[model samples]
Target: MEKIAITTDYITLGQFIKFIDVIPSGGMVKYILQEYTIYVNDVEESRRGKKLYPGDKILIKSIGEYRITKQ
Candidate 1:
C-alpha cells in the first residue's frame, strides 16, 4: 500500500485535488465522484467532499492508490 501521511486532522476537497496530480483541473473531484473512480475503506465513495481520516484506504483508478495513516 502506498502510504500518504496526513499533516492535519482535516483536508477539504480542494486540498484533495493537489494530492491527485494527474486529473485535469476543473473535473478531478467530479470525475472521481461521478465515475466512482475512488474507493474509501474498500467501498466506492461518490461524495467529492468526503472527509478522509487516518487509516483510510483510498483507491484512485488509473492513477494509483493511497493508504492514509496518522503520524
Candidate 2:
C-alpha cells in the first residue's frame, strides 16, 4: 500500500489517476478505467468524476493500493 497526500477537499478519479501516474494520457485513462476496476474504500468505482476525499482508500486492480490523506 502507498499513501498519497493531497491538499484539497476532494479529487476526481481521473485527476487522481493522473496524479498517481496510472496512465500516460487522458485517452489512456478512459480506456484503462473501462478495462480495469478501481475500488474506493472497498467498493468498485468507475466514474472518472467520482469524488475522493482525504482518508479514502483506492485500490487499482493489478496495480496497487493508495490511501489518500490530508497534506
Candidate 3:
C-alpha cells in the first residue's frame, strides 16, 4: 500500500483524492466518486466530505490501496 502523509489531523475524502492527483480539481470529486468504488477501512464510502484521519486505509477499485499517516 502507498502511504500518504498529511500535516493535518484529518482530511476530507475529496481533498485526499485531489492530493493524490486523481482529479484536477475539487469540482471533479463528485464525478470521480460516482465513477469509482472507494472503501474506507473496508466500508464502502461515497461522501466527498468523509473525514479521514491517520491510520485510515483507503482502497480505490482498480487503482491502488493507500494508508494515511502523519507527516
Candidate 4:
C-alpha cells in the first residue's frame, strides 16, 4: 500500500499529475482515458479530469491500485 500525501480534502485532476510514479503524466492520462485503459472502483473510467476523493481507488493496469488519502 503506497501512500500519496494530499493536503486538500479531495484530489483534483491536476494534482494527480504529480503522481507520475504510479501513472504517467500529461498526455499519458488522456491517452489512457481515450483508450478506456483506466478504472475507478471497478468501473472503466473514461474521464481524465475526474476528481478523486479520500478512500477513492484509481486503478491502472501498469500501476495496480492507488488509494487516495488526505494528509
All candidates: TM-score: 0.72, 0.93, 0.97, 0.70
Clash number for candidate 3? 0
Best prediction by TM-score: 3
Ordered from best to worst lDDT, the candidate numbers read: 3, 2, 1, 4
Q: Positional deviation of 29 in candidate 2, in angstroms?
A: 1.6
Report lDDT (CA) for all predictions.
Answer: 0.69, 0.92, 0.96, 0.65
- Predicted candidate 3 versus true structure: per-residue lDDT over 1-71, tens digit per residue: 99999999999999999999988888999998999999999999999999999999999998889999999
What's the CA error at residue 35 for candidate 1, in Å? Answer: 3.6
- Report the error of model 4 at residue 20, Å: 3.1
Root-mean-square deviation of Cα positions for candidate 3 versus the true structure, in angstroms: 0.5
- Where model 2 places Cα greater than 4 Å from the true spot, the runs are none
lDDT of 1 by residue, 1-71 (tens): 68877789865544565675655674566765666477778887777677888877788777678877677
lDDT score, candidate 3: 0.96
How does model 4 fare in lDDT?
0.65
Error of 3 at 28 (Å): 0.6
Residue pairs with clashing backbones, model 1: none
Off by over 4 Å in 4: 22-25
lDDT of 1 at 1: 69
Residue pairs in steric clash, candidate 2? none
Residue 24 of model 2, lDDT score: 82
